[model samples]
Target: MPHADTLTVVHHDDTRTSYTDVRYQLHRDGIRIWSDEGEHALTDILMTHAYRQREARAS
Candidate 1:
């Protein structure tokens, strides 16, 4: 069965004029599995996670 997963935006900075800094965390079964911080939108983060999962399953 798939693990129960949760995505959370732990930090966000909108003060920059060029881009926003978004920090995110991914938790599986109530434990942190991954986390990253960068100038990325929420959709970008989600898509990245999806891509990683797909690649993992393929390999």
Candidate 2:
């Protein structure tokens, strides 16, 4: 797991790259909010859920 206040690079094999800043916790759920433009909330939510689903399978 990444440490608090760290940055993680997000990328896609096809063609995409992004940098996510680990912001504060989301109500102690250990869910960290990635620093990004709030205007992109829809995309953020979708991407986050997809990532979490993949992690679940890997685990």
Candidate 3:
């Protein structure tokens, strides 16, 4: 997975190149994760919980 500031070249060849933007956007009540599959919109509470969960696992 790529962080918000990281830009990745997901696909590249002779004729075409594709770059993936791993960034999140903050909104009034939620955050949005851009993806090729679909955009994931999470409320503030859920975003906080996800961050906490990742922190707990890292610790």
- Computed on alpha carbons, the lDDT of every model, listed in order, comes to 0.28, 0.32, 0.39
Of the pair 1 and 3, which is ahead by TM-score? Answer: 3
Report RMSD for candidate 3. 13.0
Best by lDDT: 3
Give the range where candidate 2 is weakest over 10 consecutive residues by summed lDDT. Answer: 39-48
lDDT of 1 by residue, 1-59 (tens): 12213333332342222222222334442222223343233322222221222222321
Backbone collisions counted per model:
0, 0, 0
Candidate 1: clashing pairs of residues: none
Clashing pairs in 3: none
Ordering by TM-score: 3, 2, 1
Misplaced by over 4 Å in model 2 are 1-13, 22-36, 39-59
What global local distance difference test value does model 3 have?
Answer: 0.39
- Quote each prediction's TM-score: 0.17, 0.21, 0.35
Q: 2 or 3: which has the higher TM-score?
A: 3
